[model samples]
Target: MSLVESPLLSIRNFYKKYGDGCLFCTTDSESENPYMDGNRCLECGTVWACRNLNFDLYQGEILGIVGESGSGKSTLVKSLFFNEEPTYGEMYLASYRDGEQNVFDCSHQTKRYLQNHELGMVDQNPYHGLRMDYSSGGNIAEKLIAADYSHVGQMVERAEELLEKVEIPVARMNEPPRKFSGGMQQRVQISKALANRPPLLLLGEITTGLDLSVQARVLDLIRTIQQELKVSMIVISHDLGVIRMLTDRTLVLNQGRIVENGLTDQIMEDPQHAYTQLLVHSLL
Candidate 1:
């Protein structure tokens, strides 16, 4: 009954299979996994990793995803954004105009447009997301170009403004991502991701590589920008300390399954799952 609550993004009976030797695929279906060779679903049992996984993300809410390596955090989030299609069940994204639509069922063009105008993602390493060869300004400008903003000059100006907003000085705009410090590069990545003013930002361990002070600044900057823009975000991190400070709600994941989901405070103060309790305990 409690699971029936509304969520901005909801996943039901979600399933995924990776590839040959990747357990995600082998066990889900009776037929031989066609796409790849010999991969298997990790869960040969009722639920090895994720089975009947259910959760909801509310608008303007920072939903923290916490889990150890190979916990299906990345897999599940990717599915939500339509980057990776789920094997069975459904995932929906709330649209401003069209209401909620199934992510996997949506047309490629529709998903691409939503990814541009409404969604943003910052991965574990900014290097993977940022164009290393392009200047910071160019990187930021590229999004606008992709969005078909006709006024390149105006967009460049806005890019500069965004660089400043993310704490990247104007002098560094001409520099490539390789020249920036990890923190600075991550900031530039954030700037580029936010260039189109997407309504939702999906961040996966984005601040992991930065030092404490830099991480603090980036966190503050994100909070500031989100408040100013009224943007919604989903942050995935292994650090409960960071999640406790940054998120409104938290989900605990282990071995590719969600063990706990609740308000951030509740999860932090009184964890229900053993994995969550262990994770919270390990936070510094």
Candidate 2:
């Protein structure tokens, strides 16, 4: 099925909790209520991550999810990408066939296709997503291998072009990621993730650890890549500044629930929720 006709992606009522809710009360199932237990705030409750979260993303648009530390931003991204399982709730992604709604309550066929072909992920630390010891070309080529590219030479050639596209010097393509600066390493990560041109790219604070100048450059590169590739992007970050630059629309997450959702400019200029207001101020 073509991506244009696909249902895109959706998440509904996703939840995750660990350990017994009570120190003394040991129960096998925490399913009585996925959000919380009977007696009130448990240890996990103290963290108070995502509660009854619902969100969606369509093709060719960037959706920014922003919140304070521990707001479940990272967890939500992880759950969508299959890095972590949701304790409860449903997530349906990559359901881009005709006559489908992309509901989380649907069958697993679409999800499997997404996991294998339609999704790409970038983490806060680019090194974590790449092989530091291998040459820049190696880091990118490995991904093509995983994606089942049979032509090794073609993969290397493609990797070289991607490196050039991300502004990495072609001369240094053979050098290991460890020798490159933080910004350069990130470019490699982006190139590797984009090699197959996945429909959805999940970016987890991809710019946070870099310096201000590097951050701006990487972010701009990402924007250019997104538009040129026409891929959907989901950027999860605590930095409102980064979100404002990358996304056309934003979802303000507070304690795992969306407090506000609107166009990025409008939401940043006139935030409706207290949490959104606070976040906007922090950016200022």
Candidate 3:
């Protein structure tokens, strides 16, 4: 996990906005514009959800993105997962084309290829990540199918194995996620995300809305999976406690920009940015 090695994923000048820009709200001039409020353009009401995000996710590393609401933590991950299109950016994946091409500029089919084979996403809401009506095993089979899995027996076996990895009972594999508890639903989602054994996983607030005990179990599951599979992950959460438990490096975002980036322990010990300092103090 040396930083000197080439990154698994590299993002540069990434930006995502909700509305069309006005004369006073261009990305290059927004900082100097008098009509701008934080990440929003006061003149046009355009909200820049992510602004010039630049970061590298190294191989087999867990990178945490922590920020309060509206800090673009979720937006960054959504953009990476291709749930939201970026206004402009270059994303280079070492696993894709030897990191020579910008994925953003690639074709739609190529993006779909990346999504199916190279990436996995677990959204904060189970509704967003899972087909609640589908059986837990079916949900995982859906992902495996997308990755070209054809044998029903093998897919079922894989599903069972993944479910067990997240501590879900094999007997409940045929039950729909709608019938499961919140923690169980999240576990199923995690299993589905890992169905393809993707190298990069995007987890957006996966532990939110669960009980404290359930949260602990889910967090432990994530750690175990990372260690066992060596899958690089981008973990997005508003809670620093969750970040501290799961991340090796951390990014502190504010108003759509990354205000701080460093080792998780260092960021917790001595946060440099004012907003990050407030976050650390609040954690204490």
Candidate 4:
């Protein structure tokens, strides 16, 4: 289905569990309960990472996912990236498989191609998202390589273009990320993530560790990129401010379940769930 007619990406009844809660045995698992918290599972020494998560990301939408630590927001990102397989769920990208093929059922080769071309991720940790040892250009090149771009000059030119777009000096393309400040390192990561122009961009806590000033710049850069590229994005962050400023729609997860979902403005002004109310007030 076309993005205008259907979601660019859609997830239904998604679950990620661990230990005794493995996918095979989770048919009657308590983890499916929206109120089931980890402590409940931990008391029994199991882990229910995420439960019954359902959402839709419209084409070119910037959707925000917010929750406290251990709320499964990060787990959601991992599941989508295929870094951690879900116990059971169905995910579809209209850009691929007609939004009908179960992503989890895709073969390894197809999955790799999708990850490299259909999806891009800005990891929560710069170290995980970027190569510290590689020069800025090299880091960008790594992504290009995954997409099978082999022309050295063309890749370099594209790398410089992305760096410039992220406001990094093209001259510093040879500098290792280790020499850059935390903010600069994040910029490099953004440049690399966008190298292939993936249709869906997954952002994991992109601004958590930076100074206030740096965070503003990075968030601004993200906003600009989203507008210019018209890419749909799923942004995971605990900061309500981040969600308010960047996201058009918001999902509030609590203990692995989505407690609230609506337009960012509505959620902020009149949070429905108790947990979400507390979360919104704490930001005041």
Candidate 5:
């Protein structure tokens, strides 16, 4: 499908709080701001890892979510990627049903189908995205298999093309990712994620823990791929630099809420929220 004028993904009032509601909750009525209104379970202290995470991902755009540890950035993406089931909310993907199907309500099989065909994720940990036991080519083939591509000859041809696009030497295609450096493995992960030509890609802290030089190269590769493929993306990260380098727009998360959101340059150069100001300053 071609890029649309509307957002490719829409999330409304998403919530993912662990445990039962707090003792403060006495009736069916609920506070719009449950966390601040003392709705937390008084007995167990349950809290929303992600709450009211509302946003839209336009086709062919990169949106960044930045937050500190425990700030729910991971939870938010995991929920959208269907790794974690959100408590309550509505999610729609343009590829699914003309923005009609709530992604969260799809059956397990349909969810898997959407995940395999419509969306791709390269997680912070390579293990989450790569088959450590499989050769790099084999790993890409796994994605192809999930997408129902079974022509062995074509799969090999496509896999090599992907590896080349991500700047991985085609000679290394037969080697297991374990033999590659962290940066190389990440490249392979990127290749795998893009193998299916998914409409949306989910990036989870891909540069964390890498050397600065490695991070720069990976970031460059991501920028190149997005430009070449015109894929929409949701980038999850704590580093403002990564967000600045890759995203057109960014959202700042504090205590699981969107503290601020705007163009990447605007958010960095003229932050509006106090937390966002501190976050921008921390870069210095």
Candidate 6:
């Protein structure tokens, strides 16, 4: 799908750090400083998970955030999903208040409303995304309920529809996620995330730990969802292969900074940054 004129979501100067900044590390400057080793501050022991992250996700576009572990790939998505608050930065959602308001400064109630209605997240771990004890259908119904679907019949039908979309058999709707395989659990998570028909979806290392065949299936499902539902997605992964297969544009992150950003094909064919070159070569 082609990107829209304006960004559906925009993040500006985003930063997330684990500790209080000391005099040696704290600075107003945005340029790379000598105070830190990689992403960690030598003086204060502060770890900057994300620093000065600026990016936009356009309508119907799949924006991939690729990095090695601890490169802030998960941190970026977690912040956007409101699981973690940014130390500093602004996030604007075009669907919310005409993209004028900073989402980080919004009231807790407003954030909850956005989570329930405007955004959906599929975690890398099924344990984090789904309730192991809940019935597969019940899980999707939970999201629908949060979206204000009060009718029991409608919720059931919607849950069934979502399950089928993810290729889960209707017969297994009553089974608990704990009883399902890892791949099946991930599929259930995908269905639940789509339950509200959210305009923006955040997938954090979703295909990690799955078998090759299962991973392909999940990737295929995501592509189908984008094509059919026209939902914009931010996919975070350490795997460049997944990013190349799924994303239209890719952001290469290193030591909490985005080192490169461009078309997925262009980035794959000719990565500029040393870290990106290593990633591309490793893929080859």
In order of appearance, the predictions have TM-scores of 0.85, 0.85, 0.97, 0.93, 0.93, 0.97
Name the weakest run of 10 consecutive residues (lDDT summed) in model 2: 24-33
Model 6, range 179-282, lDDT digits (tens) per residue? 99999999999999999899999999999999999999999999999999999999999998899899999999998999999999999999999999999999
TM-score of model number 5 = 0.93
Model 2: number of backbone collisions? 4
lDDT of 2 at 62: 95
| lDDT of candidates 1 onward, in order | 0.77, 0.78, 0.93, 0.88, 0.88, 0.93
RMSD of 2: 4.8
User: Tens digits of per-residue lDDT for model 2 on 1-284?
Assistant: 65565446777777754443454323334345454444235445434356677777887889999998777888888777776666677766553554254434445664555665767888788767888999889888877776678897898899989998989889999999999998888889988888877888889998877999999999999999987998999999899889988998899987566889999999988999998888888776
Q: For residues 54-161, could you state the per-residue lDDT of candidate 3 as single tens digits?
A: 999999999999999998888788878887789999999999999999999888899989999999999999999999998999999999999999999999999999
Runs of candidate 1 exceeding 4 Å displacement: 1-7, 20-50
lDDT for 208 in candidate 3 is 92
After the best TM-score superposition of candidate 1, give how far the Cα of residue 226 lies from its true spot, in angstroms: 1.9
Q: 181-214 in candidate 4: lDDT tens per residue?
A: 8899888988888998889899999998899999
- Evaluation by lDDT, superior candidate among 2 and 4: 4
| lDDT, candidate 1, 1-284, per-residue tens | 68654556667777664532344444445354454322223334223344457777776778888888777778776766667777776767666334466666778897777777777788778877889998899988887877778797898898999998987889878999899899998888888889988878888888887999999999998889877987878898888877887899888877655678889999988988887888878877
What C-alpha lDDT does candidate 3 achieve relative to the native structure? Answer: 0.93
lDDT (C-alpha) at residue 208 in model 5 = 84
Q: After superposition, how far is residue 138 of candidate 3 from its true place, in Å?
A: 0.4
For residues 1-284, could you state the per-residue lDDT of candidate 5 as single tens digits?
85547789999988778778664542334335443443255456776576667889898999999999878999888887889988888999998889998989989899899999998999999988898988999999999999999899999999999998888889989999999999999999999989989999999999987999999999999999999889999999999999999999999998777879899999988999999999999995
